[model samples]
Target: MWLSNSSCEEVVVSAWGSGSEIGVEGDILRKVEKRVKELGQWEKDVFGNVKSELSRLRKEIAKEERIAMGDKNTRYFHSCATKRFRKNSMEGIRDEGGVWRTSQEDIGEVMVNYYKSLYTSTDRRVSTGILDFVSTLIDEEMNESLCREFEASEVASALQQMAPLEEPSPDGMPPLFYQHFWSTVNNDVTSPILSWLNSEGLNGLIKKAELQGEIHGYSLCRRGPKLTHLLFADDSFIFCKATMEECDNVLEILKKYEEASGQKMNRSKTSLFFSKAIPEEVKHEIKAALGVPEILHYEKYLGLPSLLGRGKKESFDYIKEKVWRKLQGWEAKLLSQVGREVLIKAVIQAIPTYTMRCFKLLASLCNEIEALIKRFWWGQRGDRRKVHWVKWEEMTKSKTIGGMGFQDLAMFNDSLLAKQAWRLLNNKTSLFYKVFKARFFPNSSLLEAADSRMGSYAWKSILRGRDIIQRGAIWRVGSGEKINIWQQLWLPRKHPTIPLICPLESFENHTVDSLIDPSTRTWNEQLVDGLFVEEDAMLIKKIPFSRNVAEDTLYWPYSTSGNYTCKFGYRFFKEEEELQLNAQTPPICHKHVWKEVWQMQAPPKIKKIFFGEHARMYFQQNMH
Candidate 1:
C-alpha cells in the first residue's frame, strides 16, 4: 500500500542548465576548439603575472581584517577554512567528474588548464618548491656579483675616511695593523697549536708562556723543548728559557707551526719584555743576542685604572651594582615559583642570618613579588591605590627578631667575617687564611689579630656579641671546672675569662676513677636507673672557675642549688634546697638551660614548657 502511493505522486521540475551542449549548440561546439586554442595562449601569458596580483589581493584582505580586529586579536580560523575548502574543491576537479570525461585529448586539456590555474592559485604549495629553488640560485649569483662590485668600489676608502683618528703612539711610531687577524688565527692557527699541546705532556708550559692576564685571550703549544704563544690568534710568540740554544730552537718550531697552519707572525708586535731580576750575565747575553727589552717585568700586565681615580671607583661600583641586580633578578624569579606562604616563611627564617646584601636582595624580592601578585590578583585594587600590605608585621619588624625572618644583610656580613676567626685559628696553614694574613695583617696572629684598618662599626658590633659568649658561663664538672672547647680554640686573646679544662680532653676520656670511684658504681647505676638526671650535670661540674663567676653570682640561677644526685650524675650547687623551693623562678627558663646542659651530656628529649599568660601574649605579638 505505501509503495503504490509513493509511485503515483511523482512531481517533475525543469530548468535550463549551463552545459556546453545546451549553451553552445552543435555549430558553436565546433567553434569551441578554435576558442580553446586562443584561451590556452592567453593563460600561458597571464599565469605567472596574475600570481603577484593574487598575492596582493590576499594581503589587502588580511590588512583589512587586521585593522578591524587589531593584530593580536586577529583569528586564523577563517583563512584556514577557506584554504582547506579550496584544496578539497581543486582535488575534486582533478578526479573525473560527471561534466568531464577522461579521454586522452580531454585529460591533456584538463591538465594544461589545471597547470595554468595553479601558478596564480591562492594555495602557496603550487609555486613554493620550484620558485624557491630558482630564487635561491638567482640570489647566489646576485650576491657574488655584488661582492665583486663592492671590492672594486671606493667603500673601503670611504669607511677609512669616516673612522676616528688612530690612537696616538709614543715617539710617532705608526702602529702595526693586521687584517682578518683574530678570525684567521682562531680557525687556521689556534686549532693545530691546541692539538699539538694536547698531544704533549707540556700543555701547562704552553699556558704559562702565554701569561696574557685575563684580557688578551690566546692559545699555546709546547712539544719537547719547543713552546709557542699564539698571540691575538694570528701571531706566534715563541721562546724557550731552558738553554741558550733552545731560544733558536723555539723559533724553528714556530716556523714549522706557521707553515703547517698557513699563519705568519707579525714581527712588529713581537718584542719581548725581559726580566731585569735575571743574573746580569744571563740578561746581558739574552739582550745582546735577541735584542729584547729589559723591562724589569716578565709577567703580562693588566691595564686596570688606578683606584685613586673617580673613574675607577665608578667602574667598580657599576660592576658591583650590575652583579647585585642580576642576583636580585634570579631571586625574584625563584620567589615567583614559590607559594606566598613559603616565601614569607623563608624570608622570616633568613632574617637571623642578617647581612646588608641579603637584606637588600630580600627586600627587592619582596617588592617584586608584591607587585606581580597585585597585578594578577588585585588589578583594580592595585590601580586605585599604589601601595599594598599583606601584613603590617612584614614591613615593621627588626630583622633580628622573628618577624618575617628576612636577613639583616649588614649583620649577616659581620657574622660571616666573625665565623672566619674559627678557620683562622683552626686551619692556620690553609691557603686562604695565609693569603688573608699576608694581605691584611702579615705580622699578627690570625686568631688574635683584628685588622684595625679594616674594622668598622659593623665588625665591632659582631665582635662585641662574640665577646659576650667568651666571658659568659663556666661549667663545673665533679670537683674540676672547664669551658667549651670552641671557647679555648677561637675566643679572642683579650677575652675577660680564659677557658680552662681538665687534663681529659672530653667526657669519654674521664675514667671511673675520675668521675666517682669504681666503689660507687652500684649506687651510681641505681641513681641513673631511677631517674634521668642528664650527664651534663657531671660535665658542667668539671668546668674551670672564672673570676667573673664570683662577680655575677646573683645571675647564676642554678648555682643556688647544693649537691643533689640525679639519674645521670650528681649536681653540686651552693644551695640545692633553694632551687627545689623557688617556685617564683621562671620554670620555662630553667627548663631551657636544663635542656641545653642535658644535650651536652647526651642528646635529650625536649619537653615543651608552657609560658604564663602575660609572657605568652608578649611573645606572640613580638614574634609576629
Candidate 2:
C-alpha cells in the first residue's frame, strides 16, 4: 500500500503548521494525525521513491518540531494532549430532593459540596472506643522508642538523601534548595521537622512501615528514635503503623503542622502503599483510617518509582515512552543534522538518564531506545529507514576522534549507575552508603555484595556498574588506608592491575598502607621492588603520595581533574568498544563547508550575497 513519493508529500505537507498560540499548534498536530490516518495502509505504504520528495517531507516534519522545541510550545502541547479537563458545561447531577441539576453553577456547587463532605465530620461525638484502642496500641517499649528526641544528625541524614529535582513544596522551595543551603540553614530547615516529630500526638506515633526509607541505611533510615512525620519545608509525609491508633495520631500531628506551616494538605495526590501481603480486610481498615487509597506500591515519590522488587521492563517502559514522546514532536524534523544532534544529545537521551542511572535498563529496552533514536537521526518514518549512512556504534564516539559525540544510551546508563556506585564506595560516612550497607550488604562492601531474591532494582543496578567504576578508579595514595593494594584499582594501567592475587597472609594484613613507607607516606620502594617484576614495580613507583593533609583517595583517570563524570565514563566505554572514528579531527576537509552552508538558519539570498562578495574579493586578490 506504499503510496508514491508525490502522494506522501500531498498528505503530509498540507497539514504542516506553526505558531505557539493556544489551539493553533494542537490544531496542526491534530490535522497531521488525522490526514496521515486517512491515508491508512497507504500512509504506512507511502514513501517517496525519489529521495527529494521524502527529504522534503522529512524537512517539513522537522520544521514543525524544531519550532515547537525552540518556542517552548512542546510542553504546552503535551500538557494539553495528556491532561483531561472537565467540560466547562454542566453534566446532569441529581440534587438532594431528586430533581436534576444541569446548570454549570449547580454542577460546580455539587462538586464542591461532594468534596467538602470527604474531609468533614458530620457528627462531632468523640469515640471513646477508638481512643481507648489507640491508647492500648502503644506500650512501654514502643513509647520509649517513639518519644526519643531527634538529633541534628538524624535530620541531616534525611536532608542528604533528598534528590535535588524533587517537587517544590507550597513554600516554593525544592529539595535542591534545602540541599544547597542545608549547611547555612540546617537549623532553620530541620528545626520544624524535628519539632513536629517530637510533638506529642493523640496516640502512639510511628512504630513501623507504616514508613519505608532511603538508601545508605544511616541515621535517616532508622525507624526509631521512632519518626512519626518528616516535613520538607511546607511539604510533609506522615509515617505510622497501619493501625487506627497510629493513623489517628498522624492526623492530629498533620493538623498542628498545617497551623504552624500554613500549607494545606493535597489529599488528591496523597496515597498509601502498604505491604502487598497484608490481608484485604486489614488494608481496607488502614485505608479508611488514613483516608488515602491503599495499594501494594505507590510511585509518586520524587517522580521516581519506589520499587522494592527486581528491576523489570514495565518499571522502565514509562522511561522509554518519555524518551519517544520527546522525539515524536514533528518540529524536530526541521532541524539541521547539527541541530538535531544537539537536540538528541541534550533533550532526547537526557530525559531518561536520571532514572536509568538509578536503575539498570533492560537490554531490550535499551535496544528499543537506540532504535528509536537511530530512526530519528536518519529521518526515517515507521519501517522506512532512510539510509543510516554510518553504523550507530561509530556515531557514539567522541568528537575529538570524530563521531558525532552522541552518547550510546546503554553505555551512558552504565556510566550514570557507576556514579552511584562511586558514591557508595567513596562516601561511606554519607547516609546513603550507610543505609545501602544495612539493607543490601551488611556483611560485605558494595563490590563484595551479592544479589538477593529480595534486592531492589536500584541496589542491583548499582552493583551492575560496580566493575566499570572500579576499573576507572585510580587510588590516589595519601594515608593509603582505604585503598586496597591488591583488590582495588591501585595501578594506572589501561588494564586492571592484579598484584599477585594470593593469600592475604602473603601481603601483611592486605592493606595498601602495608606497602607504603610509614616515615615518608610514600610507596616502600624496597617492599614494592621485591614484590613485583620491572613493569609492575615501575607502575607502583609512579603512584604519587602526599604526607601532610591529603587523605588517600580513589579517582577516575578518564577525567582530567580525577573527578568522576557521566560524560567521561561514557567516553571511556565508547573508546574501549570501537576504535573507529566516523569523522576526522577538526577540519577533516573544508571541501564540504559550502555544502553545509545551506543548512544554516539564514535566508538563501543572504548566504548567496555573502559568498558572492567573498568570491569577488578572492578574484581581485588573485588578479593583483
Candidate 3:
C-alpha cells in the first residue's frame, strides 16, 4: 500500500480530503456509515458497528479541524492520526538521574532541587553609606505594599488567577481546593499567608509566582467552555463576535459574576477587540449593542505593543516613544553616565523584549532605537547636547573588544525571534505549539512547512526565524524510517545553498533508508545514482547510516551537545550584523565626545569653548 493505516503521516499528503468526501470516502469507513443510514445499523454487523463509531469520530474531528483551520476542511488521514500522539496534559518529568517520579511530592522535590541549584547567595557586607543610598531608592509605595492588609476581594481575585487543575503542592491542595473550602477555612488560610507576606515573606511572592487566582474557563452557568472575559489583576479582556449575540452573552455573564463577587466590569473602560476586521456599518451595530466602541488595536497589551503594523515605519515608531519617555523622565536628568548606561540596558531595552521575542524587528527600527540610546549615552538631554567619543557600533561590541558591551539591537532582535523558533522545536508539549501542529502543519516537518498568506503576523514572524533554525538543526538518524531525503534537514556540516541530492519527482515519496542496503547498512549505489544527480550521487556515499539505534531526533548543529540557548543564533546574527552595518555607514559615536568633556570637573568657560577632535569638520561632513 502507498499509504498505511498505522499512521496518517507515513504517507505524503498532497491535499486535504474534500468536504463532499466526508462520510463517503476512505472505503472501510464508508461501508459502516452506509449501514447506519439504513435501519438498525448497530445490529447489522459486529465489524460494521465499529466502523460506524469511527465514522462519527471522524466527522467530529473534521468539523473541529475546519473551525481551527479557518473553515478550510483539509487534512490527510495520516496527518490526523499523527496529531493524536501529542500530550495535552502534564506527564511529569524524570530526574537528572533518569528515573520518572510518579508521586506528586517526588516530582515537586525534583523541581525544587533543580531550581535551588540555579540560585546563589549574595552574602557580601555593604557600608552603611551605600546601604542608606540604596534604601533611599526604594519607592514609598513599595514599602506600603509590603505592609498592606489582604482584603476578601483581593484574596478571591488571587484565587481566581490559579489554574483549577494545577498540580497539588507539598500540602496536597490546589487553588481549587481552597476555593471550595473558602467559607469554612477562610481565616485559617488567609491569616497566615497575609501575616507572612506583611512580616518577612515578601520575597516569597516574587520567587513563587505560581500563586495564581483561578484558571479562566467556562462558568458553571454556561454548559460549554465559552470564556467571554478574563481578569488578571486589573487588566480585562472581553472577547465576542461582532454581533448582538456576543454582547448579550458578555452582559449576561458579567451581571451574574458581579452579583456573586463584589467586583464588577467597568463598562466605561471596557473595549472590544475583533479577531477579524469588521465593516464600519457593522462596527456601529456592534457598538449600539455592546455600548463599547470597536477598536482596530490596543495601544499596548501587557506592556507590549499589540497589533502594530508589520512595516518598519509603523511598527518601530512606538519603540521610539518608549525610549524617549524613559530618557525624558526626571530620573534621566539625575543619573550619571554609568547610571544612564544601566538604565538604558536594564530599563529601556527591556521594554521591547516581550514584543521582540515574537517579531523579526526591522533593521531600521533597531537603528532608530539605537539612535535614541546613542543620543542619551552622549548626555543629550532634550535639545541640550554633549560630545560622543566612540561609535555606537564600537560601544555595542563586547567589553573585551574596546566597547561597553551594550548589546547590538539588530542581533538581539534576531536572537529573540530565534528563541520563538527554538520553542516550537523543543517545547512540543506547549499549548501554542500543539495548536500550531494541529492546524497549519499537520502533515509536514518544520523545514517542510509551506508558507501561507492566511497565516497571522505573529506566525509569519516565527516563520522568518525558520531559516536560522534550519541552519542550526541536524537530525539524529536512527531507523531512518521517519527521515525524508528531499524534504527534511538531516545532514550535518552541509551548506544550505546545496540542493537536495534527488529531485522531488525522482524520489517519488520514499524514506531516506529506502536508498540504503538494509543488510549492509550502506547506500545502494545503483538506487542512489538513478535518483540523484552525479555530484549529489557521489556525496550520498559519504553520508552515514546509523546501525546501533533506530530512534530519530533533531540535534543542534552547534554540536550533538543537545541543549537549548539563543547564544548560537546571537553569535551568527552578530557576525552578519557587523558585516552589513560596518560596510554601509560611518560611526555615529564620535559626535558626542565634546559633550563628555564638558561633563568633567573643569572650568565652565574652558568646557564651553574646547571642541573635541574635528568637531566642526565632522559636522560639516555630515551636513551635506
Best by lDDT: 2
Task: Tell me the whole-model lDDT of each prediction, alpha carbons only.
Answer: 0.36, 0.63, 0.59
Pick by TM-score: 1 or 2, better one: 2
Tell me the tens digit of each residue's lDDT in model 1 across 432-539.
455555654566554344636454333343343333223232323222223233244222221123443443345433322233224432224443222223453343
Give the per-residue lDDT of model 3 (tens digit) for 1-624.
111233322111211122234322123223323322432322343234665788999999978975665432134554676676754533467777665443344467789988876684556576778766664655889889766776766877788788976996544445664565456445434544454434323123212221332222322223223443555766766544566664565566555444333235666766666545678778778777768755545365666556665454675577778777877783555776557766888888887777788776777888888888888877776677776666676677644323466878777776777678767776666656766665556677665677787776677777777777765566656667877777666655533334364555656567777877878888889987877777777766777654354446665555224433577667666655665667742344533453355345554335324432333554566667
RMSD of each: 32.6, 23.3, 28.8
Residue range 1-624, candidate 2, lDDT tens digits: 232245644443332222223123113223334443454545445542445677999999978976755533245567666666533433478655454444344456677887888779999899777777665678899999777787778888887798877886544446764565455445445555655566543222232224332111113334313335554644455554566665665676556645433234677768776655668788888777767775334353665776544447776688788888888774546875556766888788888877876877788998899888888877787756576655676567554433456777888889999888887876666657766887787877787788887766677788888888766677666677776666676777654544445344667447777887777667789988877778878988996654353455566787655667787888777766653343433353532564455335664455445444544555566568
Predictions ranked by lDDT, top down? 2, 3, 1
Runs with alpha carbons beyond 4 Å of true place in candidate 1: 1-203, 206-402, 418-422, 454-624
Please give the range of 10 consecutive residues that has the lowest summed lDDT in model 3.
8-17
The per-candidate count of clashes, in order, stands at 36, 20, 21
Q: Pick the candidate with the highest TM-score.
A: 2
State the displacement of the C-alpha of residue 151, model 3, in Å, after optimal TM-score superposition: 21
Comparing 1 and 2 by lDDT, which wins?
Answer: 2
- Candidate 1 lDDT score relative to the true structure: 0.36
